[model samples]
Target: MAGIGHITQDWEPVVIRKKAPNAAAKKDEKAVNAARRSGAEIETLKKSTAGTNKAASSSTSLNTRKLDEETENLSHDRVPTELKKAIMQARMDKKLTQSQLAQMINEKPQVIQEYESGKAIPNQQIITKLERTLGAKLRGKK
Candidate 1:
């Protein structure tokens, strides 16, 4: 940046960014009609194995199982709101989804969701993992 401003070159002190050119220009009707591409060739999806659907179907079952397990082991105690907020923020800042974060912490995604939603209080082991995995502290200062 030059300290001295020059009027001859039409120089401004502040830098302005030119917006990228857009598609606002009118397209020719002939060109527009030509660009419209469609074909009579119908492409059909490949027939998948029965196992493909089995894999898809299993996910729902696994989810239900996890939900059932979480319900059974619901945290009777309430976790501190601040700690939950911290965990949620840290997890988000680290760009880790609940499932991904849970995988890193060796816990289920339901656990992470539960902790964030205040549906379940994390145990000490889970807390330690959370702190280590997220590079955050679920525990308060001693």
Candidate 2:
């Protein structure tokens, strides 16, 4: 029996150093600056955000801190027990694996596993898809 490591092929990595054209870099810089000026998709981190009062908006700082806290403190308990049980029972009734159930709903199997195992909470759209595919209501009832 051979392990995956033993089955590996010979390989070589190459390092090439090339200076990018100045015009393209300048064009990109101008485009990024325009976007930042227009308040488009990018957020710029300045050289001195740490322990500095130079930042204009206190609300931005507060919102960023709140977002960080919310992300770090997510709860598995947010997944409803009723929804979990309903998905499980329906899958069993149909004699379907989690992968099969996910396929029927046009989702990935890992998504089904995540919701069923209470590691994640489904949104309204996902709940609707589950209800339709599983033939069970995930909302608006006991």
Candidate 3:
């Protein structure tokens, strides 16, 4: 009994102390918050893109666009046919074939063909080249 007396145990609740937040820990928390915000922003951007694509897809069809293209073709056909003749004459005067002229101008031969055939019109830059190379004045130029 004297050597091994019963030890009285205090069953008091043990409180665990958490470490105080330091400046580095606060910085880490801020980085985590920034990452979460960035993730949310990315999700929002993806949703917006999906919505826009859906709206665009729903609005138009190929058949309607084709009809519009047909009207455009009709209007193009009405452009005076003399421009085509001028382009062809210019090429002939230069002793240049369509492919040769296209090479000189850095355009495709088909582009020259389109201009000569009056299927597609050339803009002012080409008009200048046509005049210079062909030595002929366009119908409406001064």
Candidate 4:
């Protein structure tokens, strides 16, 4: 009889051992937990601050209700009065006569007088020019 060779077979099923959790995996879990906690704390702080600020601001505004209009007036009062005063002041401060100011703005001296006297309303372009000349804010509208 001729010699024959037999193939070897794995009798036991190949087993894969479960891997132990790596250091990186543990670090990732810790970082995720810390981030969640920090987010929660930030939200809580914002809510608390918003509530107090809202209450404080509302109360302060309520207390100053009487002075609101007056403050607005001081800031820049009447449509006509403020514009007139601002123009005059700017002219005087610059030591420029009404005629000079008019020349600078390309208008007649009478036109400047009319504007200051509230006999006529200056257009936006003129007012802007006056504002620039006077270094003060002129009235836009009420």
Best by TM-score: 2
Global local distance difference test of model 1: 0.78
* Candidate 4 structure lDDT: 0.74
RMSD of each: 20.5, 20.3, 17.0, 16.0
TM-score of each: 0.45, 0.47, 0.43, 0.41
Return the TM-score for candidate 1, rounded to 2 decimals.
Answer: 0.45
Q: What's the count of clashing pairs in each model shown?
A: 0, 0, 0, 0
In the predicted model 3, the residue pairs found to clash are none
Q: Which pairs of residues collide in candidate 1?
A: none
Quote the positional error of residue 9 for candidate 4 in Å. 99
**Arranged by TM-score, best first:** 2, 1, 3, 4
Q: Candidate 4: misplaced stretches above 4 Å?
A: 1-79, 140-142
After the best TM-score superposition of candidate 3, give how far the Cα of residue 76 lies from its true spot, in angstroms. 4.7
Top-down lDDT ranking: 2, 1, 4, 3
On a 0 to 100 scale, what is the lDDT of residue 100 in model 2?
A: 89
Better of 2 and 4 by lDDT: 2
CA lDDT of each candidate?
Answer: 0.78, 0.78, 0.71, 0.74
Q: Candidate 3, residues 60-121: lDDT per residue as tens digits?
A: 77767767778433444422577877677767877899999888777788878888777775
